[model samples]
Target: MMRPVVYGALAVVLAVGPEMAQTRPKEAASVPAKSLADYSEAMENLAEAASPAVVQILVQRVAPVGQGDSQHMGFVAEQQATGSGVIVDPDGYIVTNAHVVQNARHIDVKILRVDERGQAPHGHLLPAKLVGLDSQVDIAVLKIEGSNLPTLSFLNSDTLRQGRLVMALGSPLGLQNTLTHGVVSATLRQLKPESPMVYIQTDAPINPGNSGGPLLDIEGRIAGINTMIYSESGGNEGIGFAIPANLAKDVYLKLRKDGRVRRGAIGVIPEAITPALAAGLGLDRDSGVILSDVAPHGAADAAGLQPGDVLISIDNKPVREVRDLALTVFQRAPGDELKMVIQRGKEQMTKTVAVLERKNEPNLLEDQASYDAALVRQLGILAVTLDEKVTAILPDLRRLSGVAVAAVPAEYAGLNPGLLAGDVIYEVNTKAIASLDELRAVLNEKKSGDAIVLLVERMGQLIYVTATPE
Candidate 1:
């Protein structure tokens, strides 16, 4: 009996050991290793893991200015807007775009229960309060009434590589619970030269209601927060951008603490290194940022750095453009030491610059943009009030004062020829528009089809534009 038991044990070891050895090769494979045939199934799993955290943001606010009957000017009419958001923390902290809830009187966040066996699932609607908003970065934080809520973790966007698969989960055009898959086309895309935040560009179908949604990577991590699209027709043109999730997380934490973003200001004004400037300065590269001015006694000034130094990197990270430098500086806090690499007349040297808090310094990069909420739409011109913020961005505007053009609707854009966003309207039909009320008073004098001349200021020059409103 003992001999037979020994033989049986030897047989068991031989049979089981061969199978175990086959399973555990020199390289350990992922548990339940994905077969090549399960590629489509993997994407489905990613969406399933993240879908439960995507929330629909519904807002009710006063109707956009000039949206109602012409007879009832300034009448408060109810208007509704729809967008998307994602729960980032288990305690019900939601992340969304600032523009979505800006000035909204009421906000509702709907949490979805993901369905694995079916195609659609109903969600729970809960009231959410705006915790904080940073319109500059276009990020907002909201608090909902729940605990142990479904949440998604954010991945460091710096690790994102171009051509990696990403999925945009949101509500597009009021269609709830939508998912679109695409690959990252570009990273570090900036809208302007001095934009403090960089974007991840993807060829995804992001539309009106898709703002503030989560852009998830294959691992179901939040890579970015869907923000805007570059479209000529006001529709998805395959160019959608997202705020990096890392930036969104940082903004969320700071906004929660102080209700606003506290940025590190080095007090160095940088300009794009254009071809002519590069050639003149003998810079081997023509793309990096150049320190044009260093404010007296500021962080950059205290660091023994001088003007005309080409900034090449920060903290050993390469700074390829002006936005890159600005974004890195914005990420740091006061008293943080930043390691910088600069090209000084063919000599590449590294310097340590201390970051300081920005005190009342105007964010010069904030563009003077208009919104429909401030303009009467029939005139097809959406203008915004120009104040210190606008003047800071365009120093030339400091001397001029008036309402700046934010948008020109397409229908009346041709009629109001030469009118463009950023053009400050100093006067409307001979009446100076020092304030919004003054501009409204001037427009109250106009009749249908009446010809109007606007004294507009654009880029240090003044001109008169004529238009007739129907």
Candidate 2:
């Protein structure tokens, strides 16, 4: 009986071992390898189709000698910076970041040429002209001498949702034609409290040289323009930000046509109503936007808008936050009217406010002033006293008397003075300065290399700017 049992166990083991080996091999072979191969091939095809429109940007600009420290005084040097750009029009219109070409004396764009085998082997560099740049939005338009160039079309970024697949293509770390993939982390991200502009946030592994590159969707359309990265070690940490294609497209068209952007505003300070604010102020509702202040004699004031009024809607669209109101006003042109509904106490009322163009933009001020007469070489800025002519073109000022910066001369641009066009200088070293002569007199009193503090009004805000005489 023992011998028969041993023989039976041996037979069972032999049969099961061979069957297990065969079944394991068959399971390992059924991994859907063809599906993975097809997915990779699809990605490769997308990259091949989209790469021709992307370009590497090389810029040479006059920079301060001590590694961009403006305190270096008049001493300056030339520096080269690398970035990326995307062709937007077939006629050679490229979109990039303004910071990429700011103060650039020369700009070269490297365009790639695809071979018959669908691979980019080599490319040519072309000189690009700065058509226009708006630093407020960090968008610039460039023109090259080419016709029927490869281009990318802008996608409706408003349709972009979190978790959507996206791709970032640029010259990261100066490596050209680099592509990184990730998903949208967020939308409508405002980095600053006072800023009206918003950015698209992603985890697309952006690096130093990725700025101004195009962020693409699965279909190879422009979803946004890669602008910045949130990293602690100066490398990609899987967090990046981009300017939405909708805003970029608007700025591009405006800059391409007029070389500047004209933003509109209604003279009221809108603030987001939080739960704490509602409780503190005894508001009727705990959410939505509220009027914190109404500018005296401005459009909102003329429309009978008052502080403490809760904004319900603008132009039939709901105003849920300050961004809602701000964006609506920003998109409107001067003289456009917005029908607004507001809740005040127990009464809800509708009002119409006309949007006013913010004429105090740096470019507009530069255009309106006479450079020869307004040139103030001491501070390297063109100054105009707040006389009637200058006042007529400017927005409401904090003070009626001051010297306004009209432009920064190209000759002294390398000096890197902190002053910008449209800044109204109200005080020099705590002394009131109502005219350019007064400002010049104050500067003349100071010796070269002496530090001076200026109290200036810029974009309806008051701030102090410090600089040394050149």
Each candidate's clash count: 1, 0
lDDT of 1 by residue, 1-470 (tens): 89999999988767777668687653456644557438779877877778888999999875435544465443445689999999988898899999898757789998886457775657878999888787878998989988888899999998999999899999999888899989999977777754687899999789999999999898889999999999999999999999998899999898788666766799898888888988998888767789999999998999878999988889878887777788888888778899998988879888899998765333312223323356555455666677765554345563456876666544344345577666778887777888766777777778888888888777678888887766
Against the true structure, what is each candidate's TM-score? 0.67, 0.75
Q: Write out the backbone clash pairs for model 2.
A: none
Model 2 Cα displacement at 250 (Å)?
Answer: 0.7
C-alpha lDDT (0 to 100) for residue 12 of candidate 2: 75
lDDT values, one for every candidate: 0.80, 0.86
Q: List residue ranges in candidate 2 displaced over 4 A.
A: 1-32, 67-73, 114-121, 280-282, 361-470
TM-score, prediction 1: 0.67
> Which digits, one per residue and each the tens of the lDDT, describe model 2 over residues 272-295?
889999999988788999999999
Best by TM-score: 2
